[model samples]
Target: MVNDIAIIAIVGGLTGVTTVLFGFGGGFVVVPFVYQLFLRQPVVANHALHIAVATSAAVMIFNAGWATYNPQRRRNLSANILFPLTLFIGLGAVMGSLLAGQLSEAVIRLLFIFYMLVTIIDCLVSRHFLKGSEARPLSALTTTVGGTAIGTVAALLGVGGSVMTVPLLRKHGFSMKDCISHANPLSLPVALCATITYTINGWGKIPVSGFLGYISLTTLAILIVTGGVGISISQRYLPKIADGWHARLYVLLLIAVLVAMFI
Candidate 1:
């Protein structure tokens, strides 16, 4: 038991570091890690990925809060755009969470793989759009679309939607830094809604012990502690290293990670 907790903490720490460096909370890492760790146990293996995702999101709420507060002390995020879109995202999140209960693990895994592939393709093909002029008027529409897509993906896979949202935002002319900064706060509504929906829908379905619905409280606690430390470290240094080529590298890395999961 102590060994398992230590393993989870180590993985969570690695995930937090990756998230900080990449500006994505470590859902990609956490999901697979949890899946593998619990693969042999009767510990609800089918829902491991979902639990990983939700637990990661719970951790992100903490990381995002820290990130948002640090920056807001200097300048406010563009909340005017974030507010309306959050409503749609919140709605979509609830819908997606409910849907997760009805879907099988096979279906959710396929959807997650498909979404990752699309994200990779978009990153490679639309690399040119990363530096275009910001479409201020279109922010609301774009936010809605982005939020809906993100919500669906988040509930389906337990990822925070950064894999999709970050690239999309960059394609629409936002710099990587601003895109990440904005996404941290933007994610809150979807996370909150999805967490709630998953809880409600998963009630009485998930076996209790270390779980609340599909979320594992024990796993969440470990992730929070390590991820928090990692976020602080990453925030202090990541901005300096994140350049134009980093996105392509991340795309390749994500693809490799996804392929490894199936193998």
Candidate 2:
């Protein structure tokens, strides 16, 4: 247990770095780690994905909140681009969480993998993301429609929604920095909605200790502190990264997490 906690603490720090540098809000880092860890415990093996997703959602709430305060990140946010989109994402998150609670762990994991693969392919194929200039005003249809989709998938997979939002923003000519920064703000809705939904939906579903519905409270406590530490440390150097490299690394990190899920 001691070693496991230490390992989780380390992962928490990494989550913070990713949250600050990539606006992942700890979802990408925490999900695979928690999922695999829980799978190793005989008592929780069957419930691993549920716990993993729920706990990731719980962790993301704070991670996103902490990341949002970064001065550099805050400057990139656009009220017009964020408003109605955020409202719709929250609605979609509710739908996604309910659906997730009913699915088999294997099915959910596969869906997460598929989502990652599609995002990776789209980013690689889209030339606009890499050479983005001034961000244009977003269209109403894209905001309402796209936001809902991002929230649904993100909540279902227990991710921070940055994977979808960052790419969407980048495609619209937002800089990698702007996309990542805005991703933190956008993820807050997904994280908040998913947490409440997962807790209520998962309650009593798994008769396990140290759990609240699907969430692992112990892990959440550890991650809160360690994730905060990570966000603080990573913020110092976020400005040093170039836009192209930042975008490339974001995709690479997703590929790595996708591979990690298999392992």
Candidate 3:
């Protein structure tokens, strides 16, 4: 029991920083660690991946909320700019979560790997094309479409949409900080919608020790508190980072995550 608390708190704290800086909710990092934990319990092994994804989504909700609040307050980002994408991202998250519950684990794993590869390449390609282009606001239709795609992929992969959304936004000419700012709010709806779907879909299917429909309520509570503290600390350091470095780091991290996932 004590060990579980320690693990959740540590992961939650790391995720808080990543969620604020990259809007990833650290799922790429969290899922693997949680999967190993679930593996230790034979009874839950059958459904471990699902629980890991769901739990990650649940944890992201609180962290994403903190991530969004502080930045919007400091940056004074317009809610009007974020609303359309947010709405569509939420809708897509619901649909995505439903689809995820229906798919086999093997398929999901393959899809996750494919997405990482595609995202890395996409980020690299965009660096070339977007280098000198003038920054422009994404249109409402574009935002909605992008949000839907992001939410669906995020739910399937158990990540906050920022992993995908931020690069796309950067490609479209937004600053990394601005992209992270917008991506943070987008995560709220994605996490809420996906977490709900996981809870409902896994109601009786998940048999893990702390299961509350794939969300371990105990872990959720720990993450909320520790993750919030982490977010607060990271926000102060955000401005010191450059956009180019962030993009590069994201690609490296994704490659490392993919290797870890396979191993």
Best candidate according to lDDT: 2
Candidate 2 positional error at 30, Å: 0.8
Clashes of each: 0, 0, 0
Clash count for candidate 3 is 0
Question: Candidate 1's error at 119, in angstroms?
Answer: 0.9
Per-residue lDDT of candidate 2, residues 79-169 (tens digit): 9878988998888898898888789999999998998899889988899876666678778888888889999999999997999999998
Q: Write the per-residue lDDT of candidate 1 for residues 22-78, one digit (tens) a residue.
A: 556666777777776666467577666666666666666665556556753227357
Which regions of candidate 3 deviate over 4 angstroms? 1-5, 71-76, 128-132, 237-239
lDDT of 3 by residue, 43-63 (tens): 888777887888889887877
TM-score for each predicted model, relative to the true structure: 0.86, 0.96, 0.90
Once superposed on the true structure, which residue ranges of model 1 sit more than 4 Å away at CA?
A: 1-3, 72-76, 129-140, 237-239
Q: Give candidates' CA RMSD values in order.
A: 2.6, 1.3, 2.3
User: Which of the numbered candidates is closest to the native, going by highest TM-score?
Assistant: 2
Model 1, residue 139: distance off in Å is: 4.9
Query: What C-alpha lDDT, on a 0 to 100 scale, does residue 191 get in candidate 1?
Result: 64
Clashing pairs for model 3 are none
Q: Which stretches of candidate 2 lie over 4 Å from their true place?
A: 237-239
Candidate 1 weakest ten by summed lDDT: 129-138
Write down the RMSD of candidate 2 (Cα, Å): 1.3
Clashing pairs in 1: none
lDDT for residue 91 in candidate 2, whole number 0-100:
82
lDDT of each: 0.67, 0.87, 0.77
